[model samples]
Target: QIAQESEPGLAVYALAAQADMYRWRGDHAQARAVLSKARQLAEEKGLDFEQRGLLPVAEGITLAESGEVKAGLRLLSDGVRFLEQRRAKRELARARFLLAKAHLLAGDKPQAVGELRRALDLAEEIGTHQFAVVEGQHAVGLLKLGIAQGVAPCRALAEKVQQLGGLGAAEVRTGEGAEEGAASRLEIYALGEGRVVRDGHTVSSSEWRTAIVKELFFYILLHGPLERDAIGVVFWPDVSAKKMADSFHTTLYRMRRALGGDVVVVEGGQYRLGDVDYWFDVEEFEALVERARLLPPHAWQAEDLWRRAVALYRGDFLPEVQRVWCVPKREALREMYLEALVGMGRCHEARREFEGAVGWYRRALEVDELREDIHRRIMHCHAQAGRRSEALAQYHRCREILKRELDIEPSVETKGLYERMAGKGPD
Candidate 1:
């Protein structure tokens, strides 16, 4: 309409709008084309800010949605800088929201949550509903925060999303979602080099069959080596002991065949993963957490290491494996995983990555809200970052939770942290 009416300014707006529509429809190519045209038109009209800010923002969204996430993030960051210089808060919010979405898609939950919170604040300030966008971002952010902070809000957000009938609805109810979608034809990962096979042809697939063997492989990869007896007891608990052993052997045989002979080896009657250069998400997660823990105290790389680790923990290990025996191990590993996440958030806090640290801490609390140490850490992170009111509020929340759930008082450590924040001696 703008083009037909010869309204060049409106034409730019129209192009941007069209790009967004295409992006929402998942037609990233069309979005990119529209954004490119908008960029050329903005330059032709000598609209410096629009050329630098609007064009790159649109381009970044298109690129990220199209799976070129790193490139898209770079472009969006540049665009955000330009918008910031112009004091364009609304545009900046939109850019940040888009960047957050890109990060979430790339499995960088901490970064995504930070950006989402920033966008939320901006959106609220502008009085824009942005409910759809904000809600989705908040849902994912809350879930990640829950994993790090041991808080209930993350799960609550997830539940809210399901109540509203969202993509994660099933996940909220069952605590399991569909595995990550198959990689697109052009998809590639930097960590591992291999072609995904589909129908006996390498067409760039990502569908790993979620059989019992595959789940066991993932479990071993995450928790590291398990005895054959323990594995059978956990996964095949309903079957008789003799039958379970046979099942284990059969499963292992099939897994070896599917994953290739060299992927797993039995040693001393315990199954262990073999020498494989390929990256499994769970293995990457453990390595990242270990690296973060090994980092010197107050090191800047600690947060980065933790971020990488948390990103790989997409969900609970073998979420569908729901036998009673499996629950203990799964929950135990989840608790340990949450602790590692809390450690990462503390690292981020030491580096003054306040929002990032908050994200991590929140995720930990989501996993286990009863951990007093995490509550204290969150309070300290908030206070040290100059969010004193939020810090105090966190203390109050801890007090309330302790009172309501455990019928106990805050620990000396937690009280001490809060007292210091209040400029008083520990109670």
Candidate 2:
């Protein structure tokens, strides 16, 4: 900004630097706005290639964040080579940081971690630990992915993240990064029956001080940070305001006691579950499904990703919760689970393993038997496997379910498929 007045040419570099700062802070719209100014200025001034290279790396990181992983990778990879040619370790550190974001977005956890390690080393070598600290979310997120992938967390990196403050900051500052061990790490299994486990021990019913306390734990975990008044309404709107206050505080205290004092973080008049390096099953389950979406739909990696996702699903999300707010969440998650199952089935069908394909499609139907598409797929599988009688049986069953449950006849597609198959008889 200062260079814009005294030296407009240098403003291009200033804008690139500003764009990166915005990207690190997750203000991508602002970052792009900055990048646009930089590009315009560079073009108007007829800047050299070296002067414009910084813009691509910054733009590539934003592009990656916007889900254009392939295009982003091309630019960022070019950025990496550009920095390497110059042997600009500091700029290369920034490129690694940028590339790490792209790689993580591309679902390449190992490569993301490798980029992060180099970024950290380069930052340290260049005495930019403060810069690393400012981009703490990137550090913490990649570190968690590494841990999930069986890579150990580096204490040195964790310290820089602590300086930037967030959930893991407390643990690192307390010098309990590793020494606290996995035993203290809570795993909230909200996907199915909603259980909490720690240290290989399932927290018993007695562990929760009261029923509301357990309910509120899920509320915080799922809904994220919420205001006290808003939460009071959700959990105890029926009671008098004074009574609601008493009950809310009581439940909050019990929650803290049962789940550790630092587990609940209060900030900006909102409460959020924090301070611990805990795993929420819902997050991992959703992440796997999303990562699968990033890959080619029919790729083996996508298939395997769905398999892992569905395995963690266990059942519908928080089935016991009857809150109105949870209903849509449960329905949405069930849809994702169904998608994974159907994806697996299609993968099998693509391989001409009709038997296995039918099995997976059947599982999907079991989750929600009203799925006409799954029913049709099963029929296709049967016909593919030359099991005409079973194919006919599936059609009859689909007809009955649609009739009884939805009070509707089979669609034209279903009817047409059955007609064609019946006319052919056995293959």
lDDT of 1 at 129: 35
Q: Give a tens-digit lDDT track for model 1, residues 97-184.
A: 7777666645566776677667667777887735433435423433444334333333555565666664365555443421122121
Candidate 1, superposed: residue stretches over 4 Å from native:
1-210, 216-253, 261-277, 324-329, 353-356, 385-387, 423-427
- For model 2, the superposed segments whose C-alpha errors exceed 4 Å read 1-183, 296-298, 424-427
User: What is the TM-score of candidate 2?
Assistant: 0.56
What lDDT is obtained when candidate 1 is compared to the true structure? 0.64
TM-score of each candidate structure, all chains considered together:
0.43, 0.56
Per-residue lDDT value at 13 in model 2: 78
Which has the greatest lDDT?
2
